[model samples]
Target: MDVIKKKHWWQSDQLKWSVIGLLGLLVGYLVVLMYVQGEYLFAIMTLILSSAGLYIFANRKTYAWRYVYPGLAGMGLFVLFPLVCTIAIAFTNYSSTNQLTFERAQQVLMDRSYQAGKTYNFGLYPTGDEWQLALTDGEMGKHYLSDAFSFGGEQKLQLKETDALPGGERANLRIITQNRLALNQITAVLPDESKVIMSSLRQFSGTRPLYTLADDGLLTNNQSGVKYRQITIAVIISRSTPTEAGVMKNSVLVIPLLSARKTLRASLPTKGSRSLFSLSSSGPWSFRSSLWC
Candidate 1:
């Protein structure tokens, strides 16, 4: 039995190094899984594997401690340190709404711009990597044409029409026939550029990555003259419901608001028998579970 155990491949120095190398690869994979999914199970498993690796190395005394120390230190630094850091961040206002510092929030709010009742319906066509914009004033029914439209300092190709304009060759010819151009055809021209921007019920025509990121972290619009300072925008969900037989019923109304503020004060509904007195605010709020019995 002793002779057979001596002949085993694992007893060889090369096989021992190969086994250690494979275990190191497994540790790397576990670390990546923990990072991507933020799963605690992966972290726990990593610690178990690391402990086993350390035990095997110390017991065998085949490899030097230098390699073993680095692997154990790396597991502690990347895997365990991040887990502790995330738990610490959970207690703080690390979410989008309360993201920036007070000074940064003020700067972002001061830079916000809005144009009232100004609408531009755009027709976009693409050739190669560039896109053409045919801008039409919806109310005036006037179209403006340019040979090229520059975005991020790059010019888009503009196609010329053979026919004369109805208004004796105004600044540009108008394609007044509504729904004349098929959406699918426009999409085919700029398969990647053609997209709908849902600001509200009205879908506007535009391309995404519309803004270029400056080295200073500011976003500059490639088309319009608007410049926006980077800020954390929070999505707030407000739900109102009635209390029935000492239990709060399902939410009857839901309102979703995107803003940079922490507290949202909305008027409660007055029609219910039991009125909503006030909402108890909690950071990462937890609701009590109710029994149906």
Candidate 2:
């Protein structure tokens, strides 16, 4: 009498289920890549090659070591290589300064805007994707009436008189104006690839995107008849005035610069009063100083 025969590994239902599950995952991944990246051809080719390799390995009679080498090599290159690269970057000063790929950093720094006479305060109204100024103030309670203008839209309302004061604690509100002028409690929203100017109380219309990104970097404002181009490493003010404007006029500005060196000297204000300036070479840099009265 013959002993009970054992079934081959390929005949096992568990093995079949595992293979089917793997194939489903592969198909799902391919579908996502195709929809998100629009790289259907590449995804299809990769899926076909991987599935063929998997099927060959599963059905092969001889456990050839060469068959495993290809899959192992691919895993090392795609999975392990990126992890190693990320760890390496974490040690270097690769932040907003150098961390941005050459093109991205240049774009970010170049997009910065500064105005000389415009005073921007909080409180704005949003009509669809456009924006309108709802309130303006300078010298604490000294309020000014200004009309709402739609940013990135063609609607401009005349400044009507209003006597509304923002009910809240009084603070310097320096950083808020510098980065973004939040409207009421809503976060400031910049149009895609466009930057807005925070104004001072001088009633100066701030600079805006005159040239679209499609125009290279030439900016022109037909309303003011101003035209300018992107300058290399230059602090060109978007809005300029003949006289000193703000409270911090002619004060020392310790502007931070991006550097690749491990240790970097802090920046000192070349023209303004002594103020604390900070920077992070590898990440997003911070610059802070007391508002000079």
Candidate 3:
């Protein structure tokens, strides 16, 4: 008697190798994409899926694994990993008190500074390839010039009685829309230790530092001579006040307000809440959890 032979899905070694090769290529593409975008976590998940698929197709003993590879890969890439990440993020403390990582916190605190320096009105002079910043200090009676490459230093401006305009005293600003030399804003320090900020095409001024951040984490305001520090505790308070300075008592923080104003503004409340304007004199306020007190 002759025995009958049945062909299985992975019976062809060529087809199995083809499938494995294709999965490997897909995983390689995903790895490159994720790495470029800084998504290292997702790249690892893709690598795991590729390994499982390659093992199932390349090994004859694991031929039966072909039937479940698609479902396994789908779950690992889409469902399981995302659900795990969501749960992990829920447990981590990322409120206001712990808003940034250690590195980012240090950078932010170091960059916290205010200007209280000399003021100089500026004019923009676009010269085809580059732009020129012309600064004038009326009180000091000086004129300075700077460009993209080098500071042109002080340039003599022959002032005449006719140069002075009437009441409006427009600052010789001529906007040539074709050149488009203006920037939205530029906050940078000059060689003279003065900060220059260009708010708009017509408005640019020089400033000096009025506040400095101390190593002890205090913000010293040079103008008012006030030292301010960040709030490190967790305090729950009424949302009536939105100022920076507030009183702290035990675990509760009392925000000081010179006066309280309540306006009847209409709003739609969430489910199981009172009408938007139904609150009494002790008005209702909205708040969310934060790291700051």
Candidate 1 lDDT at 79 equals 84
lDDT of 1 by residue, 1-293 (tens): 45544467657878877777787787877776664443444566566668665565646464676466777777777888789767856664456534555445444544444333335455544434543444454676655333433234222333333232222222222331322333223321222233332122222344344445467655555456455442222211222233554544322011122111232223323333112212223322322112211
In terms of lDDT, the poorest run of 10 residues in model 1 is: 251-260
Q: Please name the candidate that would achieve the greatest lDDT relative to the true structure.
A: 3
User: Lowest-lDDT window of 10 residues in candidate 2?
Assistant: 247-256
- Which clashing pairs does model 1 show? none
lDDT of 3 by residue, 1-293 (tens): 99988888777778867877887887898787775454556777878877886787677799888998898888877899999767755654334434554445545545544444566665655555455556666787766655443223333232222222222222344542322333323444455555566534544464435546677665555665655454432222322334345422122121211111333222224432312222233322222223323
Candidate 1's TM-score reads 0.25
Per-residue alpha-carbon lDDT of model 2 for 25-83, expressed as tens digits?
97767766553443433455466556655555565563584567588657755887567
Candidate 1 vs candidate 3, TM-score winner: 3
Error of 3 at 252 (Å): 15
TM-score of each: 0.25, 0.30, 0.31
Please provide the root mean square deviation of candidate 3 (C-alpha atoms, Å).
Answer: 15.5
> What is the Å distance of residue 174 in model 3 from its true position?
14
Error of 3 at 190 (Å): 13
**Candidate 3 TM-score to native:** 0.31
How many backbone clashes are present in model 2? 15
